[model samples]
Target: MLLKAKYKKNIFFFFKSLLISMQNFLKQFKPKKYKAYNKYVIVSAVYNVEKYLDDFFKSIINQRLDFKSNIYLICVDDGSTDNSANIIKKYQKKYPKNITYLYKENGGQASSRNLGLKYLKENDLNIFWVTFTDPDDFLDRDYFYEVDSFLKKQNNIAMVATNIIFY
Candidate 1:
């Protein structure tokens, strides 16, 4: 009887430790949640854009903006034949809190944009503003700052457009 009791305790402890370790291992796979500020969603459609991705990423990440606003970048990979998806993934990993990368079948730019919009709606991000950009295009460093300032001062505007300068 003493031997049986000791075996049962050992089995129970073994299972308990196994369960604890399993939970700990699963915790590493859990997705992280980020706090949203004056949440702004920047959506982009990427298709075979590997060559331009680095500059696009650098431009977005380098934005000089107030901390009161948070930028959430959502890029839809519309069946990129090249390394565009991998490039986006690199940025996503680097800025996990600010980037959401999506993959979809070969769709045109509009379809990719629609998918991104749907994702924003489904996630219910409570977004305050939205902006779009092409993978080859870059924005000014103070783009978001100026946009945020303008929107704060204006009450009736639904959309604002900035002058685009092509070089």
Candidate 2:
């Protein structure tokens, strides 16, 4: 009986030590808590949509969200022969802090967008969400507001998409 009690006590101590070591090992992999940043980044590839540029810029500026601070517009001009680059420059001048314009050779839409992503990576801002738009496409006034609401409710969402209204 004495030997059995000693064996049980040794097993208990062994398990306790093992649990402590396991917890210490797992602590190294624990995810660090990050503060929530609600900044929205919009990247647009402009080729030759000068006609629709005004509407696109206006729609983004008139969003119901904090357009002045929380919203960022990245306009990538993919060698547009039209006045698209000028329009982008105008918006960039008007809202220098919120709008960024980048010029590149006549690359495809994907390449232009990739440049925008590269800019995001280089800057390394604490952006909560990143989205894409087109120069000829416009968004509703409450679009960002609605997206923010939905994202706030769902904690595990990796991406969120909205319906497109084709006219």
Candidate 3:
């Protein structure tokens, strides 16, 4: 009985040490930042915009493009105390491949945008163009498609801005 108990204790300690080492090893691949593998990445920062998320997300999801895979959306939530996070999560679930969500402590919009840019830089996304929008804003259905077409045709253009129609 004494020998059995001693062997059991030894085995338990060995497994505990193994588990700790394994956890540390796995932390290396925990994704320091998200990878953007698309041609155009749209980064939007949100804070407690649950009321407007639906419209914002609808505009994004309804974008018309011949090559739909070229566009990506990155939404960063800056410590929203409302249901904004949940709304973003719902959209993420619906468009897992197109949308990337980042959650951070309450910093202002600039900080959130910086985090998005950091993610793109750290992950080496190599995207051709980037854009930003407010969570309460609307995007036209041909937004990405038009932008892609225009950029492809213009060689000297560094950036493009569209006219906004406010309600």
The candidate scoring highest on lDDT is 2
Ranking by lDDT: 2, 1, 3
Pairing residues by index, what is the TM-score of model 3? 0.73
Best by TM-score: 2
How close to the true structure is residue 51 of candidate 1, measured as C-alpha lDDT?
A: 95
Residue pairs clashing, model 1: none
Per-prediction TM-score to the true structure, in the order listed: 0.74, 0.77, 0.73
The C-alpha stretches of model 3 lying farther than 4 A from their native spots are 1-38, 66-68
Ten-residue stretch with the least lDDT total in model 1: 30-39
Per-residue accuracy of model 3 over 1-167 as CA lDDT, tens digit each = 23456547688866676799999999998533222223788889999999999999888766665324666788999999999989998988887877889999998999999999999889887886889898999888777777777776778887889889978
TM-score of candidate 1 versus the correct structure, residues matched by position: 0.74
lDDT of 2 by residue, 1-167 (tens): 23456547688876676799999999999643222237799999989999999999999988877688779999999999999988888989999999999999998999999999999889987686899999889999878888887777888998988999999
- Candidate 3 worst ten-residue window by lDDT: 30-39
